[model samples]
Target chain A: MNGLLIAIKSETFIALRTFASKLIVAAPALVAAAQLLLVRLTEAGQQARDSLLGGSNFEADVANNAYGFFVDSLSTGLTMLGLLLVAQAAYSYSYERDIGSIRHILIRRVSRRSLLSAKLIHLHVLALLSVLLLLVSSYLLSGMLWEYSAIVEDGFELISESEIREEITLGIQLALLPLPAAIAFGLLISVSAQSATQAVSTALGITLAIDIFKGLLGGSGPLSLCEFPAFPDRPVLFTIRQSHSARLFRCIDR
Target chain B: MQALSVTGLNKKYGSFAVLDDLNLQIDKGSIHGLVGLNGSGKTTTIECILGLQEFNSGSITALGYPPPQLHLSKGRLVAIFDSPSLHPNLTVRQCLEHALLLCEKPKRSTEDVETLLGISRFRDFKIKNLSLGNKRRASIAQALLGDPEFIVLDEPFNGLDAEGVDDVLELIRTLNRDQGTTFLLCSHQLPYLEQICSHIAILHKGKISHSDTINNLLGNTQTILQLKTAETEAASKVLETISGAELIDIDTDGYLNIRISGADSIAINQAMVENKIPVAELILKRASLAGLFREITSEDA
Candidate 1:
C-alpha cells in the first residue's frame, strides 16, 4: 500500500540520519575486532614464553587454528549483537513515542500497523548490516592471527577443513535462525512499555534472566548459553546452540 | 459536507466515563476550537478521532474516512501536538526532509515553510538544542510542507511567544482563507481561539455542552455596561426604565454595572441623557469567549 511505503520511507529517513542505527551496525564489528586483537596479542606472548622455555604443547596447536578463533570472535560478537539489537529495538519505538514524533506519521500518512511493520523491517536491515560487518572484521582478523587449516595431531587428521567449513555454516544458520523472534520480542516489549527507559531495561533484563535461568537448569546435550560454551565438540556449534533457545523463545513471543 | 462527525460516542476507562454519548460535527473549511477543562477528555477525543486509541463505542469519520482509515487520506490530514513531535537528534532541515518523505504530494519546499515560520536561521539547529518556541515553530513548519486538507492542533500555542503566536495565528488565518483548510484546534488559549476560530465548541461534563458559531454562542450571554456617573440614583432609575436592562451591581468606586440584553450603547446613553443623568466614564464589556467559557464551566462546576 502507499501508506506502508511512506511509513517505510519515513523509517528509513530517520535511520539514515540518526546515530543510534549506525551504532547498532558498527559497534558489534568494532568490539569483535578488538577482541580478536587482544586474543592474538596474548597468544603471541605465550608463544614467545614457550620458545624461551625451549618447549611447545598440543594446547598451542589447537589454539593456533583460525577456525576456532573465528568462531570464538563470532560468539562474543553475536552475544553482544543480540543484546544490542534488543535494546535498540526496545528504544526505537518507545523513544519516538516519548518524543511524540510517531504521532505525525500515524495521523498524516500511515496506520499504526504500517508504522510497526516499517520499524520491524528497518531494525532487521540494521541487524543484517551489523552481522555482515561483524563477519568480515572477525574473519579477516582471525585469519591474520592464525593459520586456516585442518586440526592435525602427529600427522593424523583430527578434523578436516571441509568438515570445519560445513560446521561453521551449520553453526551460523542455527544462531541466526532465532534472530527474527528476538527482534519481534524487542518490538513487542517496546510497544507494551510505558517509556523508552522502561522498555530497554525490561527487554534486556528479561533476556539476561532467561539466559541465567537456562544455564542453571542444565541445558540438554550441547552448550545452551551463547555467551558460554554449550557444546564440547566445536567452538562453532556451542555458540550456535547457545542462541537456539532464545530464538525459540522469541518465536513463542511472536 | 462535514469535515468530521462523531455520533453516539461513548468512552470509559474502567468504571469512570470520559465521554458519555458524545456527538459533535464540524463543517468543512471552518476553523473550530475545542475548549475544555483538564482531564475533560479533550485530548482523549482527539486520540479517538485520529485512531491512536480504540473507543469503547462510536463512529468517527474525519475527512470522510473512519478513524481507523484516516491514513488512507495520505497527507490530507495532519496533527501537531502539545509536545514537539520531532526527532531530538535531527537538525531542523533534516527533520523537515524526513517529514517530506511522508508527504505523498508536497506543495511547498522546506525553505519556504522555514521562512514562513521564521525558523530559517534555526534550520541547522538540532531539535534538542532549540528553545521550546523554536522547536514548536519547526514542528509547525513541517506540517506546512504538505497542503493538508484537515489539520488538528492540540495546544498549538503552548510554547509560543507573543510574536510567535501572532505569526501562527496569521498563518492559520491565511491557510484557512486561501486554501480552505479545515482546522480543529484544541487549546486552553481562549483569546487566540476567539481571534481565529470561526466556530467554538465547549466540552463539559463529558459532553459538548455548547457548540455554535462564535457570534451566536457569545451573543447568548449578557453584556455588562459599567458607568461611573454623577447621579448614581438617576442612572439606576434610568436603566430600570429601559427594557432588557437590569442594574446588576454598584461598585464602591461609584461605578454602576448593568447587564443589558438586546440594547446597544446608543440606546442606553440616549435614555440616560433624556433623564439628565451625568455619565463621566462608561465602559462596554461585550461577551467574550473567555468570559462565556468561564461562565459555562463555572456553572457546570
Candidate 2:
C-alpha cells in the first residue's frame, strides 16, 4: 500500500509540474479565445440588433448568451482532458526509467504489477483533475463576460436557463467518451517503452495515428458511431440548441 | 547450521566463464572475511549469493534451505556492496524510510541506526550532496536497519575516515558479540579484517586460494623473528642451537632474522636466553595476507 501511494504521488507531482499539464490547459483556452474573436468579427452586423453592443461586446455576447459560450467551453474542456491522457499515458513507463527511479523500485520488494496499477490510477486521477479544471475555468471566464454584457444591456437576461444546462451536460460527455481508450493506449505504450523519451515519442505517435485512423474510418460501414462506445454520429452542439440564435448562445456559455 | 552454503555453482556470460565450480560455506555466528585481488570474481560471487544473478549449475543454500525455498531467509540476510548503492536524490531520512518499508515487522528506529553510524547530521541531506564517506555511512545504516541474522559487506571501510572506520568496527563487534550476527565481509583491507573477522577466505582466479580462521592461519604459518646481533659469530652460534628455525637473511647492521615454522614460542625464548648474544630486540611477526598473497599469486603467475 505504501509503494502504491509513492507511485501515485510521483505521477501526481509530474503531471502537476511538467510541460504536459501546461499544454493541456493552454491548448483548449487558446481555441476558445480564437473562436470568440471570430464570432465578434462576424457579429458587427448584429451590433444594431444587440442592445449590449460596446467595446468588450464579444465577451458579453458569449458570456450572457448560453449556447455559444457553453459549446466553446465544452469543446476546450474535453480536448484538454484528452491531451492530459495523451501526455501522461504516453510517457508513464519510460519516464521512470529515464529518471533512474526504476532501479530503486525494482530492488524493493514491491511487484511490477502493483507498480503498474498504481501508475494507471495516478494517471486517471490527474486526467480527471485536468478535465475539471478546464471545465471550471472556461465556464467561469465565459460566464463573467456574458454577465457583464447582460448587465450593460439594461438587464441580466440573454439566454434561457434550460439551454444553459443542456449545453454544459453535452460538453461533459464530449470530453468523457474518449477517456477509457486514452488510458488503455497509454498503458500499452508505457509498458512497451524502455525509456521516457521512447515512451513519450511512441505514445504520441501512436495516439496521432489512432486518432487519424479513427477519423478516417469513422463513417465507413461497420466502423460507424454505432460501433464505438458512446460514439456520436452528429455533433452534440447541433442538438444542444433549438435555433441558430440558441446555438450561438450555447457556444458562448460553453 | 551453516549460515550460507554454495556448492559447485557455475556461471558464464557469452562463453566467458565468471564462476567455475565455486563452493563456499559460512557458519553461523562467525565473522568471515573474503579477500581477493581485483577481477577475482568476488563481486560476482556476492551477486550470485544474493540471488541477483542466475547460476548455470549447482545450488546455493542459506540457513540450510536452498535459495528457491529461502524466502524466509531473505529478511534474515542483508548485503552491503563495495560501492555506495543509494538513490542520490533521496535524503538519508527518506532512504531509511524506504528501506524499512521493505523489511518485515518489528520496526527499528531510524534515529538509532543513524546514531549508530554517526550519520545523524546527514539524515536530512540528499545523498548526492554528501561526501563519499557520508554516503558509505548511509549505506551502512541501511544494512544495519533490520538487524538481520546474517550480513554480507563488500569493502565497507573503503571511503571511511579512521574515526568512521572505528565506529563501524565497534558496531560490528557489538552486533557480533550481542546478537551473534554472521557476517561475510569481502575486502582487501587486511588490517581492518584482521581486527574483527574470525575466519578469512582469499579468492584468486575465481577460486578460494586460502581460507582459515585468523588465529589458526596466524598461529599455523611460520613467524619471522628479527633479532639484533652484537657478534655475527655469536648469532650464528645462537642460531644453530634453535630447532625448527631457519635463518633467512642477515643485515649489515647485525640484524639476524630467522623463520620459525611452528607455534613453539618457548623454544625460541629458551635459545635466545641461553645464547645471551646481547639481544637488542626479539620480535615475532606473523605472515600478513599481503605477503602470502604476493607469494601465492606470483608463483602461479
Best by DockQ: 1
Per-prediction DockQ comes to: 0.73, 0.12
**lDDT (C-alpha) at residue B232 in model 2:** 61
TM-score of each: 0.93, 0.67
Report the Cα interface RMSD of each model, rounded to 1 decimal: 1.0, 5.6
Off by over 4 Å in 2: A1-254, B64-74, B226-241, B249-257, B263-284
Error of 1 at A120 (Å): 1.7
Candidate 1 wrong stretches, greater than 4 Å: A219-254
Q: What does candidate 1's lDDT look like per residue over A110-202, in tens digits? A: 888888998889889988998899889989988888888876678988667887777677777666654666688889999999999999999
lDDT of 2: 0.67
RMSD to true structure for each model, in Å: 4.8, 7.5
Best by TM-score: 1
Give the C-alpha miss distance for residue B277 in model 1, angstroms.
3.4
Of candidate 1 chain B, the 10-residue stretch with the lowest lDDT total is: B257-266
